[model samples]
Target chain A: MRRLPVYLVLDVSGSMQGEPIEAVRQGVQLLISTLRKDPYALETAALSVILFDAKARQAVPLTELMAFQAPKIEAGSTTSLGAALELTKTCIEREVQKTTADAKGDWKPLVFIMTDGHPTDDWRRGLDVFRQAKTGLVIACGAGPDADTTVLKTITEAVVSLDTADSSTIGAFFKWVSASISTSSKKVDLTKADSSEINELPPPPPQINLVT
Target chain B: MTDQDSAQNALPRPVERAWTQLLEALRQAGVPSAEEGAYGFGGLPPEVRRVLTFIDRRWPGAYAASDSATKIEETDMPPAPADPPIVATEQPAVDAAEVTPDAAEGMSMAVSKQTILLKNARIDQPYQETIALEGVDELELIDDADTGLALDPEQDAAILKGLPRHSGDFLLRLRGWRADRPCEISAHLAVIPDPKSLWVSKESDREDPFWKPDAVFQRVEGELLCIGASKRGRAHAKDGLFRDDHVGVSVDAASGWHIAAVADGAGSARFSRRGSQIAVDSVIEHLPARLQTHVSPHLDALVAAYLSQAPDAEARLKGQLYRALAAAAFDAAKAIEAEAAAHDQTAAAFSTTLVVGVARKLEDGWFFAAFSVGDGGAAVFDLDAESLTTLSLPDSGEFAGQTRFLHKSEFVDYEAVAKRIFFAVRPSFTAMILMTDGITDAKFPTETLFAQHAQWFAFWRDDLAQAVEFSRANADLQAQLLAWLDFWSPGNHDDRTLAVLVP
Candidate 1:
């Protein structure tokens, strides 16, 4: 089956400690549970979780949606968005199969990076690598007022700003993500035209707006 | 009825006349036919039209046709390179390309004007052949049906195109003319089977349910006792999927040949579970006959030379055995490929790793040969020595969790494959165990663990031996082995397969 690999890069730093972290955790769980109900996502969506703080680690490797479990969110010292970006690239290279001349590989990955704070490390290098990726649709979300929308824009054209990191807003963002994933996963077909690229995502809720 | 008769017969009552008048009014209002104007873009408001136009321009396939058309023009119109005209061959056209000196050198075959003959060419490695064509213009290399490339005349002899990876009849049809007579020649090419290409998922119009039985076990008794079981991993079980590993055992009492095979289907491959099943079943079906025909004649001398430690004798024996085993593996790969083709799918959709072992009972001991294509563990537990000897070691790639699969197209190097074939003539070995990476990753994570953990094999030998002795039938023993295979570690979960042989 053609798989739509989805990676979630989340900021689990000191700033996102109590409520924000809890919201992220709950939101991710909700996203996974909702995706499980979608037959399309269950068959075609492979999910991975990357957590960035002082360092980045693949908390969950790319796994089919049926087998995927949301990783526990732990707040670390500082946001290492650069490390997270690098790790995501590595994960894509290793896990996602790129189309070749002889055989078709996996579909282009769908990546969502949610951050509530600016990177403490040099993130430009990671951004450059990500930009050079042959196949992926990256969406960066700035969670709350403290997030640097300017930096998020540099990372991806599809940037959204969440007004608050409250549970309701975070939950809405996740619900939108689940819906977008379900749409993309259902659209993918090996025999038809390429449906890997997401053209129109589900509109964000009132608390979330395009960071134009 | 004709249109005029139907129209004349429809003389309207008052309601019918009103309906006809309404239909005429709607037609006069410029209602477009569904086929001609389904979207009714003209009827949309100006603002909506402008927004739609903008969005349509950004749509994925909007520019695909134009872009591809331009690409086709560029590729198809390249000027033919200048080259001297070839002299026509009047000698009643030789049936096939003449074998060049390259054929004697190695796996290379050079053919001119005639069909290219490829015999036992390695499937795991890429092969290139020199085709000597005379008086041909505009040679087109057609790969399958959809893709074709024009060959450069100036560099005709030096051209090296990669051969097809799967085993089947491939055609290289030369459509250019010879002596301006419109002569066409087709080369019937054959690729020796390798493991099926890795399986990738395809979208279906209907829902394709992905589920299979979790585990399977089989036992066959003859000169040697063979017990094997394959179990689904915890991760797969949680996902409601079957085990991607399969095992098969075949024993020929008359020939004293005990054959056992195990295959691990690639987890990422969509239909690898089927691939693994096909591979194991094929090997068990084919290996015994292959050994008797190819290796039996030289077995006695080879074993005698091996026992005496004769120079080159062991190497010779190993080579012969390797070729036989490789041929068997290729047959298994071909079977899987054929199955995929029958299902209108590519061979890669059934990619798997294969390991097969053949052992013959001797007067005092057993003579065994084992071959493997990917990462798995095989060992002999010597009862007399109380030591475990590693046979076929796990071959890993550059990174962790990376290993070559039998289905990889680049796996055609038989010499490399030969090196991995393990052969031994031991006086007394209590048991032989072959396992997939699922068990090895948890129990023997590294080469060191494989060496240090003699107890692991000992546990299996003792438990299995007792089970075999106590159990009334093979089913009971199979159940015991299946339960034992469920041993789990904290994080490592993968499909497990184990085949054990006792003499």
Candidate 2:
């Protein structure tokens, strides 16, 4: 069976210390718990969590939803989006099973990058390298007013911005992420044409807006 | 000039070496070489394209033009040469196909002997087919005798090994009676070309592999009683799948022995449900007989020597009992291996953890012996002391989620596993419980929790005891154990199997 690999690239910089970090943790737990209940997501979805601060770390490797554990995200120093993207690329290359002549591997991975602020490092180089490799749908969400939408736009066309970083807004964003994942898990079939891309997604709540 | 010589003449040495390296990398990444076939260069990275363009400028026709083709056309093209058709002869009962020299060589080198399972056909039913070859000697059917089809030789061996690259098709005539009744059997032959492939057919999805059937209560009026229940996990239920855990119970009234066994199939294995079923069944069916043959006859002398505190006699007794249990576990592993062999699969496909135990009603109380080959919990509930004693502690590998399977080499290695077998002669115990990791993981997530969770076993015993008494007073207990086993725990959902023996 082809697995639907999902990567959650989260920012755990010093800015997201209090309620925002707690909300992200709760949101991730909610996403996993909700996905575990859905049959399609349980069987097909494989999740990995990546956190970026001064450096990037893969908190959890790609694992089946059945065995997935929500990692504890601690607040760290500067936000290094470049290191995060580089880590995501490395993780995908090492973990995602590529389709071969003899057998099918995993489905194209869905990547969601959530951050509250701009890059402290050179993110353009990482974005260029990532774009060079074949990847699935990448949705970058710029959280709070401090986040740079222009920088995110360079990484992916599907970029969104969150007006605030409150618990309610974060909760709403995570709910949308879960719903989108559930939809993709059901629809994505490697054998079919035009099934790789996320054609339709649940509209984000009022607090979140499309970058365009 | 030759194509190799022309290419050498057309490009500089360094550029040619770089191009060759680039092509090699692409091939390693499952992309066909440009010279071998049309390939899409448009989707490739700019660096790769620049190298390819340089090579193209020097040697025209060396690579496909980037602008000429689309990505879909390049990636989705069928194999260059189509597979050959099976040529059938005039004979109705037997089909004959001639093997081309190239096909024969390919078969000899690339293809290993495989067991092709004919769907909807019993082991007794015979299917006939023939393949004509041109080079070398006779063809043979090397398969297990239990498969029932009459072949030239019954002894199992590798049929494909050491055969000269022959051009003639070997005639295979299968003859056997239908196991059930005389009827026309139509079936499709399914062959698994690669042993590591976990590809389960769509037909297999019809029945959830992890679905556990409802518990069947057998009310036995004796000092010892046995009840076993298996339940599909919440994860499996959400996924519309069957339970991968299986349990079996057997009572030898004459021998005063009640045996319970549980097998938890590896979650990742494609056909582990079947493996767990076979493991449990083999243990229940084979263990009692083995105990009777190997341990029963010498029990008196061994017990007397053991009471006297003789080191040699105690070692002998322990060795004999361990050997008996080990043999039974080995039989279970062998059964799974045999099943995999029959289906042309690897033993890993049927990986499962095994726990089996026998409880005898002694003059003093109960004599218990159990063997566990993986990660699971087995405990004895001491009624008199109102305490729980773990019989076989879970054997976890170095990693947290990793555990040994019965079919794994380490489990089959008797010398390494013999000491792990558990035995006890308690004066009195209310019940004995055997369970898969699913239950223990939920109820007792940590070793500390397991040590502190005597209430968990007490809960089951009290509930089951009441149910048993109620059944005695009214009607039989209607599968309440299954519902009890379905208790939910977050993020720890897996197939739950529990077997309890109570007096």
Candidate 3:
């Protein structure tokens, strides 16, 4: 009767405007559709998305995937993966620390960050703060030709390089992502128990991107 | 086991009463979990489960990476940051003439029916794929057999990793053999070899490393077993008989767990033989102590710890080892990274693959966890997956048998991407089998060999006379799984090893 939590720390920086951000939106919906089909993921996984530009915006909070609604994709000025990073750090720290929440804190939640450009803010500082709280998996994906993605790679040890922003891959990549999640969830259940004694939470989602 | 089930149903009354009293007490003290079913049952059983979940929920940064085999429990993590070089690689233009609907549409269609055994896509089509979940949330989906991370054609080392989809080899589609059956299976699979030229030692007329019929596998009772089968493959004069490569472990009957591990050093690297010895010695030497030091003492954790830290998780694995090994494998990986550096060589300098296993015999039934890494593969015959098939762990999307980032590095950041992935794999399961790449390619889909319970039960109680006799007599089966370095592995004289343990 426990649930799995998933958060999206999306990069809505300046460079994501043209086709990149739109592809991300479509992918998000595809992810939801994929989860709805899996008996395990639907019952266990929850979704939340935060969009960051010069500042961070919460597209959605920690809502069940079944009840999730697609938020509007709004592009803004400057690439601030650092600010988005910091916002993500706070939101997750709060969610994990929330004692009043219904479900007992589940697996350290999975956080996926997608970005086109690099960080316009001081990345080192944000990274220092983020690394200190080791309760989650933070995977960053860099997209497009102009995005300065160098700084985002420093967030988590796992950084997936997405080659093109081609709208076609957006759906395929998400489907692949969903398939992997289903497989891991199945492996997790088979490997451990549902009683919560093993604490061997299934691995968080992988970071992926669209090649432009 | 049935009593345990009954115990699960009999909610704790006394503890529930105590919880009510405590909640009342906390009313004055300002605490919670006050009433309702939350307090409906509170006893050692429920409390134990509650405590475990609570600790995981409350502890920030306690969970380790999926790749690691341990948890980070209530420890102070040093301030470490990740910095993967974020240089932008120019996106190549898509060629319109070469467009295929599946490729352009991005939906992944099943290609190889041999998911049961190792198979490849078109040799010329660039067997690379990247697909996202159509609708899903968990991020664990990208590790599938088809997701290729390094499939670029121009890279130099990429070519060296292994042979590209062989032109003449038949392609097999991956099939799910255990959908409705038991989680365990016994299967027969062909051990594949690397098609590269360098996999073998040359000139003098001995067994060629690629073609050397070295690797082997078997099934006993309901259990799957692999051993140091091909001593003839290690016939080279340069390195002595690969006793380290020939290492093996066996599990006994008990609820407790057992483990075994073996590893091989890349022949091209200097001191690689020493590295191989160090890897094996580390597993044999440190396993007992690590088993005892770890709170639960799982068969899998012991092997994982030993493989990460040799002789000592304390003295040797200071930096890279810490990153490779979890800090909470009862001991921090950072504590021994220094020793790793001293013995370390570049990717080209020294490289070795690990073979490990974790096992347990529980009262409810029996449990075994085994896995392979790089090459040497481990087979698990469980009745769970299907009564008949033995499941082979799929390759980690290898270009061939070759892998990435095992090379020497200047920096030893505990959070390095390479270290986080190859090392520091969070302990997710209680039992496991780990092995070098050499053994994995040696297996072909052979479920018929291990699926019959009646046959397996006899094999379990049967003596070695029957078991060894069958294996030695089956020359056709044996040749199908020889070490590829002899037959074709990138080239042999490649070190091969395996370990199995049950507790």
Candidate 4:
């Protein structure tokens, strides 16, 4: 039950057009591919992908890693994370139901949110839902030049800002994520473990890094 | 902190002053803001009045909880996640005018005394569905257009009037079992001779994770049965050893004429996880009544019968749903095991053990049949026995020690599946348990785990009878059973699995 499922909320707005979008796509691909190869990950994990710009869409439902497929990122006009947030809550609500109370109800579920700009749609309710869930963990990442770090901070306890919004930094974050997942997957009940591994994760903007 | 003072002082502000106030209020309440000019809250009780006042100031003319807007200086409104204070001029918050229970009120509705009742039973959704009374006003079935998963409509977007901070997702209360559990049917169980692979996968390997069972399966709710797997593993992963074995309930939901099949991976097969996954998924997806009627109750014939279907189902799965998008999620999982082998990774993620249960609801009663391969065994509690007993089927060799793999193409025949199967004789008053080897070692010392849980649950149903409670009891059995592999099992460890069938 310690096997946690992750939800990735990615912003595919027009501002992330050329390389930014490509890096994101590559970043996701790298993370999943890395997870698939991990021993603990193969045994204790699953993934769900949600993409949004003007509207929100589910590229993949909650599924064990073997069945997960990285979706192609298509940049569009608006950045509507509100829809993505709403949908993410719904997805977790339903996915978690699939698990019984006796098992890993304590299994840690972490949400990795990556965005470039502020929500184009009303996102107030989405934040409320985030606060209400309290069941899972949320990590927000602000990318490129336009990302509003302030907005990202509002939604999560852990926030990260990236420079250039390129693959190197994105890939670095993913490698760290892969490590975290591998660590998290080792136990069905993650009680006491090394916090340094988790804390060492990419810090929020201004303090973000490109090297290991 | 006084509402009157905050409002009077708040009076001297720019036209967009309310926005700053909203953010300030949120921050004061430990609510972070998205922007500096974002909304803030002044001095309001965590109640509805304060939130309504804030909404009025932002939209000025839009949002209305009762009928229209009012500028009251009372701080009694609770905070909520709803439409942005500003109306959706160019950007609206999720279908804005949708009349969301004002932020301050929605939470209260989620947990209010207003009970949600599942309406009358129908064929498609025979199970009674929950209907929220005054608490929830509307429901939306937002299905992810992709994946084909139908989202629950009852909880989607609701409006609650006076929400309390204690509120969260609406507390769902299921009604009595209106219709029969989905895919109600009978099937004959076909467990190949053991002493072969299941009970003794270690004879095959010592360090591999695939050689042992890590999960258990149960049909707790809806048409889709549930599966939970775990192992204690390395010292660092000791917590992994704590699996939730509901003390054996999947084996107890038996009656006359119905068959429930559960399987565990050998932990040795690179694709054992898939083995168990495909075994369970295939049985649920395939295993028609006709097939159930074909297998004989006797274990030896069942093994012969189970073996014949192995190759066919595996090959067929590749072209059919069991392999493609519909590929049994478990089967796909098994493939990952194979991939691990190809790479010679330390995970040792290959072979898996298996256990299966087949149950049917008949005119007489619920009939159940089961099969256990690898290290695990099967048990049943007959009212006549007074306690749970092993349904000792045909084991090819010693029950005292580990064994070898029997069927050559087991992947195909897992679901009692074969062009030709021998139907089993119906048993009366039965409780059965099918499990992996780790269970036999130190976990299920009582050995009578099947009867123990059956009796305990029977006491529960006869005593404090709550269906959900009963379900939890069963899930716990699975968790505990799987945990044994993670903890007590020696060596690097192996897979552990157990399935219970009751009649």
List DockQ for all candidates: 0.01, 0.01, 0.03, 0.02
Clashes of each: 12, 14, 154, 148
Docking class of 2: incorrect
lDDT of 4 at B301: 37
Interface RMSD (Å), every candidate: 20.3, 19.5, 20.9, 15.6
Model 4 alpha-carbon drift over 4 Å, by segment: A1-3, A98-106, A189-212, B1-452, B455-503
Assess each prediction's global lDDT (C-alpha) against the native: 0.67, 0.65, 0.41, 0.45
Model 2, span B78-136: residue lDDT tens: 22113101111011001111233443343234322222323212112243333222221
lDDT of 3 by residue, A74-137 (tens): 7788766666667767777776433222222354566777777767887787777777553444
- Model 1, B1-503: lDDT tens digits are 46634433342232223223433443555654223434354553333233223222223233233333211122222232221111111110110112233322221112235444322233445665565666554444533321122344457453535544454434555544343233345654544333122122222222334345677778888877888888876556554566788999989776778888888887767788889888888888878887887788788888888889899988888888876787788888788889889888888888788888888866667788888877777877776676666778567765434566666353478667677778878888777888888876655645666775465555555554554542335556766777777663433457789888886
Candidate 3 lDDT, B1-503, residue by residue in tens: 76644543332343223323433443454433323222222222222223323223233223222212223233322111121110000001012112244332331221112122232332324443321222211111112222222223354221211334333222222111121111111111121122222123333323523222334443222232333343333223232333224354543333243545555555334444444445444554454344344423443444355556646542332232232222222121121233346655343443544444444443333433332333354434332332322222333333322332122332244444223322122222212334444333222212232334444334333521223332434554333434322442211223444332211
Model 2: residues with Cα > 4 Å off, grouped in runs: A1-118, A121-212, B1-222, B304-314, B452-457, B461-474
True contacts kept of 4: 0.00
lDDT of 3 at B290: 44
**TM-score of every model?**
0.50, 0.47, 0.30, 0.34
Q: Candidate 2, what DockQ?
A: 0.01
lDDT of 3 at B395: 35
At residue B170, give the lDDT of candidate 3: 28
